[model samples]
Target: MTVAADAPPLRRPTRLAYGFGSVADGIKSAAFSTYLLLYFNQVLGVKASVVSTAIALTLLVDAVVDPLIGRMSDLTRSKYGRRHPYIFAAAVPAAFFFGMTWFPPAGLSDFAMGVWIFGFAAFARASMSMYQVPANALGSELTQDYAERSRIYGLRYWFAYAGTFAFAAFALKFFFVATPEYPKGQLNPAGYVPFAITAASLIFISILVCGWGTRSRIPYIRQADEREASPGLLSHFKEMGVAFKNRGFLTVFGFAILKWTAIGLYGATSLYFGTYVYQLSSGQLALLTLDSFVAVCIALPLAPKVTKWFGKRNTSLWMALIGITLGTSPLWLTYFDLFFPPGHPLLLPTLLLIGAVYGTMVALSLMMTAAMLADVVEDDAVTSGKHNAGIYFAASSFATQCASGLGILAAGFVLETSQFPGGVDPALVTEAMTDSLIAHYVPMVMGLWAIGCLIIWFYPIDEAKHLANVERLRAREAEAKARDMQDAPLGAPAR
Candidate 1:
């Protein structure tokens, strides 16, 4: 929550280390979101509904796993500290399962393939939660400065988006390539093995690098209170209830759900839109992925300044509005034939321009939200008498997973309803089917994002309020410390 005015400032290397760690997260997200459904339904010949259902069912496990990991990490005391231990332990297995998800086996039935996806996805999701929940909590622990938190998250997201861009480009350019039999590189089954290995390697290495890099901060990070009792199963639930009582946490949590649900829909369908509706090749897709890199390069420097100018809440609201406008407008225009026709030279550029704007907005909004959530930790501590950043972030993670599952489910439903059969060539996809897909996608994305923006508009934590909360918390801590000193034996050293 709050730190004393004399608290140590975060060093540049430490911040960069934390930021670079998210490359693992980026690779996982990009590989899963962009290629998972396509790999299963299109290449592996699993039904769309089956693949989405498997993903959704597995993610439900997060409702239990995420908070449990958060609470356990909060109470954990070890030489390596609460967060890093889990972070380090999770990396290898997470990488193994992530790789396995792509390489199920040859000649499996649809039901068997679905079962394989579920098993591997469940493990991958669990491993990711182990690292991600605590890693995010560590960010809140790393700094108490308001603007500095924004900068930290900016670096984090910059690395995340950059990694995603690299993975996307690499997958399109090298892993997946057009062949005489498989015109679209992504539909080629053989390439997935190398792609999986590459992504898994990145995930493993980045997690270790981030964990080791931030190891020095363990001494400074908040420790478990000796006075507090160990959390029981009921206690974990009670703690979650207390976290939900914080209005600021709820605002961010709800916003994340809606925002990420929209993201889920977009991610699930993006490859489909690009391949079928826009008829983009692997090279064109690679070019489009560059939008994230360009956006982050521009946004990373500007995010903190803009947050200072507009405040995190307002900045996020504006960015969301702008993003929603940019993201959906092109689709609508193209759908109505108001933009260039599908095969026109301008179509790809137009879509790329939209991607650039939307990407920038996403970078800005994510940075603001992460910082805003960190601010809530102190406010939560003031009531609960302990900093539980892990739990709060875990709750956010739960929302994200649920939103992602729901979004993917919706995408699958849309595909099935549109009669977009599995294993069909993109060239055989009917114009009517593409139109129906966009028809389902546009309203779902726009409506969810609009609702999320509306919810965020009511977030109560501004800079002034956050600073006041921090001051109050510091005063409380000082008073408690003084009380402890007075109660100690005369010869005992001060705490």
Candidate 2:
């Protein structure tokens, strides 16, 4: 049975606090997707394959660890609660290791630099997983209302994008300013020092804020039974198997894998397109940060309303399709020379508008998926006699890491195949190189998006089914409570 639903609806301050925690995740994500490869490969002269390999390897290893952390969060009992302790403890090291990734010593060989990136990246991924897995699981615990979960996750994504914009804008505006000596500000080495420090500080602060802000939720959170047997390795796998057996979980899980891979691919390639294909300067690229800003503005209020109109599964599928179409349109248009040429006054503005819409659709899809994950918690609980939110979320996180890793690795392969010369000026890039990059990128990303869109059709839950599942769970809990009272000693309180 699920935990008591007596806790009051979350107030505005609490929701804001809860949403604010995702800022750390946002910063870390933006850093990895937007700047990490460029910094190492373009700035430091390490090969793109080497940097991508370092990132991909760490993510692959971390994917394996996510479930263990999720299972441990499920079992652990502490004064502060199962999720928060890990949440709090992860803050410092996560920031420290993330910061270290940007500060590799100068004059190192490419091999040595890759090793450095691999080592620091491993620690960074591990440390963040400590925070991310439990933090994600915590969202399912905070509320059980299906619609409310969507709203809560909408806010979560809102803050996530806000953090992304903040970090990206800051780096682009202040640190990565273009000069005569360095035409592409992103490739400037001196800027990385302050950028790392600022990012680390923000990561540390945001995580602690999330932990502190959500402490009130601990009392309302479901905890592991003190008397329940400790699960062994086989049991953990068995439990994970049970979670995946639910058709809803399986479908959403599959969709998340594909969706995130597309996202990772977009993140890995967007800068290259902006810098080379579009021939945008650093300041012009900085303006594109508004895309996320516009997305957050629209998504926060729009996602739940749209979900209410169309239902979660359908809304998610439609949004994914829309996002994929809009996001890829510019690339295809440019490829065919059907859109504004480089230096056209409308080029940047048109791209920005398209990005804004694309970002919103992606945000909506993610919110629906997260809400669906929470729904699966009860659906699994109905048959299995256990509520394993941790395992469900962990599996999703595992898919994310593995799929995103593959996407990043695939991006490396694309660059290698395109023979896009590293450590070269954007001005020196030729139309043939840009065309090869686009030709390789467009079809692969579209195929992944299409596959992901189709996977949503397999999800079994809708509003009615979800409500029915809630009723069944509540009825079961009532029976258990009555039986405990009947069996209790006369005049004693029942548990």
Candidate 3:
């Protein structure tokens, strides 16, 4: 009987370095979802529909650009390797464009403002894709071990949340500080430029540090030429079509679409909810950022174990179910007057506790989904004879972007329908407006997340199936090498 072996665990530094790259993405996502809509509509006086339209246009462009970036990364051949060159090239431009979004020229019409937003946001998304898709594909390649992938991804998510927590805590406390003139700091326009500068600087630093830290692994990773034949331009879409034929990737992609849409909706609304619904001050809201820290603590240690015990699919499904339930519970509980009311001393702490637990669930779900997606690289390779980790991850990334686009649109719809006033004092907002906003927001978010949970049930691979696929690929490799040896001329110096 033969005992099976798994890949050795990645070194802690290697894992941490790779994980650090996620900080850029984390900050960007936090900005887009949490602050972008709020700033444009509430501070800059752009219509909600206009802001959503601008962002939606950016996503439409991303829908095309993301996959092309992925395929190009897969086929790229160079001394620095497939992913790093893009990572290095994109860092500055991504930061520059992102920073520019917050500093639009004054006195532009709504149409002009929309154009400005679409242009800068498009460039920023594309530039980030240059780094993110390839970097995520790199994570997939860092190890093939079934369980260890979970750990690596767990660390990636941990760093992401850490970055998010750090930024939120600092921005709310320092940059968006309440003043006599602008008591609700989030609605203040003066703070946005400084916020953009700090965030842009961090984005630049994290991408470079990740690139440098992961440099040593380049030689060990499979080079582009070592991959199967590169597809022609016409065949690129064909390549993507074939990739989705794999059931595991398709199901995960489906789930990610819904999951991210829900996330985007929540992000877009959280500020409104906190400011008007809960009547929380910026200082009190800063305290809520602690939820992310607590989530990191809970998720980093818990993800691998739950994934191992429950399997990735089950872990993801349960986490999504629980997360959405708890995440949205405060709304329902408050509606029935069964929970803390606004200005209740216990309300903020109760929310913090709920957010911490909800954040943990979301972190676990995200980590498991990435690990599950990584596993499909081998399974798809076995069937298609092509190693296209970049395309697979890119498709997932596009789904996330596309869904978030829709989520943002939904947020705008909610605001428009609810008659939620923009560029006004939160104290001036009426209870009826907030109640109407919740009526629209909660149902839409819950529905998207629930559907996502249903789709994830269809993911077909588990540890046993993953290990089998690995062994089968290894066997084919051995047989191919044997045939090459047999076919070589006698004393040909091993060809």
Q: Each prediction's Cα lDDT score?
A: 0.85, 0.84, 0.86
Clashes within 3 Å, all models in order: 1, 0, 0
* lDDT score, candidate 2, position 190: 86
Lowest-lDDT window of 10 residues in candidate 1? 1-10
Q: Each prediction's TM-score against the native?
A: 0.96, 0.96, 0.95
User: Which residue segments of model 1 deviate by more than 4 Å?
Assistant: 1-7, 227-229, 484-495
Over 24-80, each residue of candidate 3 has an lDDT whose tens digit, in order, gives 988888888789999999998899999988887888888888898888888777677
The candidate, 1 or 3, that scores higher on TM-score is 1
Residue 267 Cα positional deviation in candidate 2, in Å, after optimal superposition:
0.5
Candidate 2: tens digits of C-alpha lDDT, residues 186-285: 8788888898899889989988888888988887777777754377888777777787778999899889889888888888888899899998888888
Return the clash pairs for model 2, or none.
none
- Which regions of candidate 2 are displaced past 4 Å? 1-5, 488-495
**Residue-wise lDDT of candidate 1 within 338-451, one digit each (tens)?**
777667898888888888888888779988998999999988887778789989999988898888888888889888887777888887888788788888789878899889
Quality of model 2 by C-alpha lDDT = 0.84
